[model samples]
Target: MTAARSSFGFKDVDAREKVRLVRGVFDRVASRYDLMNDLMSAGVHRVWKDMTAARLNPQPGETIIDCAGGTGDMARRYSRMAAAVQARRGGPDARVVVIDYNAEMIAAGIEKGSAPEMVWAVGDAMKLPLPDACADAYSIAFGIRNVADVSQALREARRVLKPGGRFLCLEFSRPSSEWLRQAYDAYSFKVIPTIGELVAKDRDSYQYLVESIRRFPDQPTLLRMMREAGFGQAEFTNFSGGVCALHHGWAV
Candidate 1:
């Protein structure tokens, strides 16, 4: 049987090979991943994340899985927000699992110190090591596009969430206008690689990153995928003129 094919940036390769290449990229950039986000987005990523969290509306004693949750940025925020809700309601703190396939990224998150409610694990998005219907909410921010099989990852996301559970995904997306697309393309292609070389010292890796974004499915397609994976009320809200998008679906 022929091996399945996958895109490693613009290049097509063996699906299994794509996994290794992605891992290597994350392993190299894990230490500086958050920094690179800041540099690339000019700190706009933080605001987007905050908006995503607000939409999540996490409650006390809920279990949230932050898949590909590098450096625990959003997971830590969710944990604290849940803890605050618990403090007010006099209930147990929320449990947030920061699960990522990259061990280096997990190590970086650990180095930053985690909240008591936070749990760390190195696991693949397509095959999360968790029981069925085990979580109340799931989130993957700017990370799902990197998965070798985005459909499988979405299926696993549905598998892990209890009925009535919520799932949110934040990912880079195509701009809505031709003018914005032109501007974004110019910035992404000409500027991001140079930033990567100067800041992350990995030009090739950043080049792949840019290519991956272009290769990723757009907002409507992703919403359709979520629906196909058994998520009800699947919808998306574009952020920053569609440079990024936040998708929400409920496992019904």
Candidate 2:
């Protein structure tokens, strides 16, 4: 039997190998991942995440599963939104689960002191360790592109969501303007790895990160994938001249 192939950065490798390689990259940079994000995006990633959470509009007592939620950033943000809703309604706190395949990343989130209402789990996006219809909303921020099989992950996301649940994804996308695209390319290829070396002492991992962003599907293509995965009303909103995008879909 032949093995399936997938991308590890620009290199093609066996699917299992790609997963291992990707996990290794995160393991190497887990401790400094959040810092590197700030350096790479000039603190703009926070704005993107906030926008995603706003669109999610988590309600009180909801169950949100943040797949590949490294360092608990999205989970924490969702928790805050849910908590606000709960306070206004006088309901119980919302439940958030932060799931990551990389144990180091999960450990980093734990060590960083996630919200008391949040739960952390080590799990794969392709096969989440949760029952069907378990979440009111599912989100993956800057993490879906790393999955070896994005389609499978999308299916998994849909599988975990209750009917009428929401799915949100925040990821890098093709820039809308030629000038901005050029500037981003130069920065990504030339500057990001240097910053990675200086801050995380790992250039190859950051290089892989940049390459993976380029390899990810564009906004419309991803929306189609979401629709194909059984999500209804899949749509995307571009951010920062399309340097990033927020994708929304519903399980109806």
Candidate 3:
């Protein structure tokens, strides 16, 4: 077997191997992840994440599990939404559970410390340390493609979601237009790694990032996977001309 690279530059990587490689990269770059995201996307990631949150439509006193949810951004957003819902319904307290395998990212998330109601755990997506039929909703943002087994992760998401629960995934997708796809690929393969080298001081890691995005299943294929995982109504909406997408389904 070829030795799995702890780092690489524009090389093909096994899907299972991607999980470990990505974890290492994210751990090393955790402190700079948010900053680099801002720089790389020119602050557009905030808008994307905001759009994802809005589509989730979280309600009060509902349980949400944010798998691979880095820096607690979604957790914080859900917490605020839950609080409002509770106030409206005169219900019990609601909270968001954030789980990620990377300690560095989880630790960085804890440091942000935005909401008292949010909980953090170091856990894997392929085998989530969560109970079945418990979460009212589950979400993974920009993190699913890094999983060792995408299928298993989707199953785990299904297992933890209650009946009528919703599942949402926000990720990079293939560009719709040929010209845009060409330009996007150019940026991913060239400029992204350069940014990583200059800002995060890790060129190889960004190369892996680019490859993982390329390897990830496109919208229709991913929706099919969601159906295989038992989600009743899997669908996706493309954003930014398919550069990003929001996939949603139900555990009916």
Candidate 4:
């Protein structure tokens, strides 16, 4: 008889099991996720996210899907920006949809009442349930690294986007300066999990967070992957001395 399979995040787990384990981590950390992020990044993550939004340059009457947009931060920002653009242009009808695989995350977003223009839903990035050419823009903020199959998720993002739709991903990346890299690594491996223990009371999840960031592909590699996924032009800009990177591309 065959032995039973273990789950993902376990050394013995198969691919599918790994995906489940990763999803479970987010679900477990949903409520305190934003707090942990602030604690871990010392509130610098907000600056990084704001920089990412600035690059997106949301316009009026456009639809955006923020894949893995936990707690609806990105969605809320985009909706507001779009609304402001509409106000200036004398037109209305812009929306931001926040989709995350974890229901707990969606619940938190809904409870927070992110924005009336923001819609929260539970969905996976790898296989979005939306129709083709539906979104004018797509973004995944600080969440793609946790995905079981990142390449597949990028493809799905491309598939759901309209021609000329923009794609942006803001994620943890390799630090540029040697000193900063060493310091960041030390903080991620040690200080982060310690903060998680004190703040979220979930050190294991925080430890996994550091591991997942270390395991993610670097900026250039990710840009290449995006191009391979059929993005017309792919490029990236590093932030925080390379502790984070923003990758942007467009469907053609």
Candidate 5:
């Protein structure tokens, strides 16, 4: 049988090796990850994240597991929403768990005070350290592309979510506009790494991140994967002319 192939940026490698490389990249850049995000996306990432949170519509007393939740951005946003609902309803506060395999990333998140009410843990997306049917919603933003086994991560997401729970992901995608795509490609391949070098002092990590986004599956392919992982009624909404996309699926 032919050997399995996995992507590490523009390079192909064994699946396990790819995981190790990705972990190393994150570990090296964890301290400045959030800042790099802002610089790379020109602050548009915050808008994308706000859109994701709006769609999630976190409710009072619900549990949200944010896998690969580096720096806990989504968790913090969700917690604020949940807290408001709880305060209004006079119920117990909702729970938001931010899990990532990179310990350094989790540490940075905790140090930033990413919502006093949320839980932060270092855990792998493909093998989440959560019980089955334990979460009311699951989310991963800008992190799934780094996973070595995207399908396994999707399966784990489905496993942890309760029946009728929601699965939401925000990720980079192919831009529909040819002109925009060309500009984005130039910025991603050139400006991003240069900024990483000047700011984060890690050009290689940024380069890998950009390449990984290019290697990620497009909108339709990811929906199919979610369906194969037992999610129902999977769909996607592109943002910024498909520069990014929000994918929603239900565990049924």
Candidate 6:
């Protein structure tokens, strides 16, 4: 039997090969990953991230895992928010863990230095390192599409969360408006890769990134996947007219 095929941007690749290819993509962009984010979305990604965190609303004593959490951007936000809640409520401090398959991305995140509450590990979205029912919340921002097995990743997320644990994902999605989709497509295809070339000096990597976004499942399909993966209940909110979407799931 042949192994399955996965999308590496618009290109179809052996499923087993995608992990290595995706790793290379992040390794090349790790150092300037945050910078390129600012350039690519003109800093709109920041607001989108904020919305993701707000939805999660890191609380006191909650163990939050940011899967494929490149450069610990979301983890840091979680740490701060969780700490604030702990301070006000007078309880155990929350743990914000950053897990990613790419070591270089983890290293870049470490270079920025995070709070003591933050823990960093190199791990896969499809097979996280933590034990079952260990986390109170799990989030992946713009990272799930890179996984060769998104369904497996969803199951792992279900596996690792305690009952009632929340799952949140924020990723680029198909726009609801035809005109906006056309404009976004034009910008994503022509401009983002060029920005990568000028800023990150790696056009091909950013090209793959944009393509991966296009390849990711849109809101409704992903919600169905979540429900099938044992998330009992799931829903999504379109951000910026569906240019991006934030998905929420509850492990029952």
TM-score of each: 0.99, 0.98, 0.92, 0.94, 0.97, 0.98
lDDT by residue (1-252, candidate 5, tens digit) is: 766688999999988888789889999999999888888888999999999999999998899998899889999999999888878877777899999999888988888986656998888898998899999999999999999889999999999999999999999999989999999999899899999999999999999989999999999999999999999999999999999999998998
In terms of lDDT, model 6 sits at 0.93
Model 5 lDDT at residue 230:
93
State which candidate, 1 or 5, has the greater TM-score: 1
C-alpha lDDT of residue 184 in model 4: 91
**Model 2 TM-score, 2 decimals:** 0.98
lDDT of 1 by residue, 99-179 (tens): 999999999999999999999999999999999999999999999989999999999999999999999999999999999
Which wins on lDDT, candidate 2 or candidate 4? 2
Per-residue alpha-carbon lDDT of model 3 for 1-252, expressed as tens digits? 775442232455665576667778888899988888888788888888888888887776778999998898888888887787777877777768999989999999899776866889999998988889999999999999877678889999999999889999999999999999999999888898899999999987788788878878999999999999999978999989999999999997
Candidate 4 all-Cα RMSD: 2.7
**Greater-TM-score candidate between 3 and 4:** 4
Error of 4 at 17 (Å): 1.0
Give the clash count for model 2: 0
Runs of candidate 5 with Cα error greater than 4 angstroms are 1-3
Model 2, 120-143: lDDT tens digits are 999999999999998999999999
How many backbone clashes are present in model 1? 0
Q: Write the per-residue lDDT of candidate 4 for residues 1-252, one digit (tens) a residue.
A: 554443233244555776788777887788899888887888998998888888888888788999999898888889888888888886767788899998889898888887767877889898997999999999999989878778899999999999999999999999988999899988888798888888888889888888878778899999999999999889999998889999999997
Best by lDDT: 1
The whole-model C-alpha lDDT of candidate 2 against the native structure comes to 0.93
Model 6 TM: 0.98
Writing each residue's lDDT as its tens digit, candidate 6 over 1-252 gives 888999999999998899999999998999999999998888999999998999899998889999999999999889988888888878888999999999999999999998988999999999899999999999999999999989999999999999999999899998999999999999999999999999889999999999998988988999999999999769999999999999998998
**Model 6, 135: alpha-carbon shift in Å?**
0.6
What C-alpha RMSD separates each model from the true structure?
0.7, 0.8, 2.7, 2.7, 1.2, 0.7
